[model samples]
Target: MRTTDVVRAAGGCVVRVGAAGLEVLLLHRVSPDEWRLPKGRVRPGEEPETAALREVREEAGVLAEILCPLDETEHQFTDRADSQRRTKRTIYFLMRPLSSTTAPTDPDFDQAVWLSPAEALARLTFDTERHVVGVALRLLLGQD
Candidate 1:
């Protein structure tokens, strides 16, 4: 693997209980094919924990309280032109919604929806993201 830079990001699976058992919140975008949790780059002098919650509220419009840390996933991606190589490790967490409202004041995603963990697993676009969600789900289920 080529080492260009390491990026710090934080986000997590926001979960709630529904008739289906447990559901996770996911943000959707079509242009780049994204269907996963809200996450973003950690600003300078920012903690990953704080960044994760801020990104979640900014992208998903819901106020959530963190339950615990899920796991961190490292993924590498190259720009379409293959000019930039970067690796990002996102720290995922398990959170519970404190309120229900689409606050998307930042408008980073096209749409946001809550889906069962199984549905989220199938709809997620990246394997690493799926793994993160799976870990969070099992933690939520006491199976982890």
Candidate 2:
């Protein structure tokens, strides 16, 4: 039997009402060439909610306020650098953008774009994130 290292992380489904409808922000990683929601590991002494807002600011370069917590998702993967299996538990928040301009401060992501819920669901590389977006949509639409 093996014990898996669990990494605590957080992120946001930053959304707004646009012409096409609710739009979610998605980050395009440079190296991996994948579309994902802005997220990162929670630092020492940092709250998960704080980490989620910081990640959104750092990765998307957009200031946002949390409307509500959307979901907490866990997934297992092998870390590319360490080659060790790990489980990432990420808490996601539903956020509303405060600033319109996007100038990503994180070098890991080269592009940040707002996409409709359907588009975001199709573009997101991970199912966990897509599910988070769905949760956000439900909350915004008063369906939850």
Candidate 3:
């Protein structure tokens, strides 16, 4: 049997109460041409929580603080560069935005925008990320 590499990643659902009620920050990735949550690999010796906050700041060009642990998702895919099967386990945190800027610093993504929960759910390319954001919305709205 071929072994699949396991990768640890973390991300945040940066949300705030906007005029439209609840809004979520999403990144528009250029390479895949898809909308995604701001996330990345957890660095060596770094905690998942810290990685999530860092990724949100780096990718969204805004600062945020974790309010609570949202949820985790795992999925498998083939790496394009190496043609190797890999499983990515991502930890997600519910975060509150600390800044107003929405410019994305990461070159991999060209756009960062805040959308309503329903809109974000519709715009997200992956079901896992959409689930994560859904959980965050429930918690924020005191439904969870």
**Cα lDDT for residue 51, model 1?**
94
Question: Model 3, range 17-107, lDDT digits (tens) per residue?
Answer: 8996878999999997999999999998999999999999899897999999989999988877799889988999989899977889999
lDDT values, one for every candidate = 0.83, 0.90, 0.90
Those runs of model 2 whose alpha carbons end farther than 4 Å from true positions after fitting are 1-4
Could you tell me the TM-score of candidate 2? Answer: 0.92
Between candidates 1 and 3, name the one with more favorable lDDT. 3
Model 1 regions lying over 4 Å from their true place: 1-4, 79-83
Q: Quote each prediction's TM-score.
A: 0.88, 0.92, 0.93
Model 2 agreement with the true structure over 1-144: per-residue lDDT tens digits: 234488889999999888978888999999888999999999989999999999999999999999888899999889987998898889999899999888889989999999888889999998888888888888788898
Alpha carbon deviation, residue 31, candidate 3 (Å):
1.8
- Which of candidates 1 and 3 reaches a greater TM-score? 3
Displacement of the residue 100 alpha carbon in candidate 2, Å: 0.5
Q: What is the lDDT of residue 52 in candidate 3?
A: 94
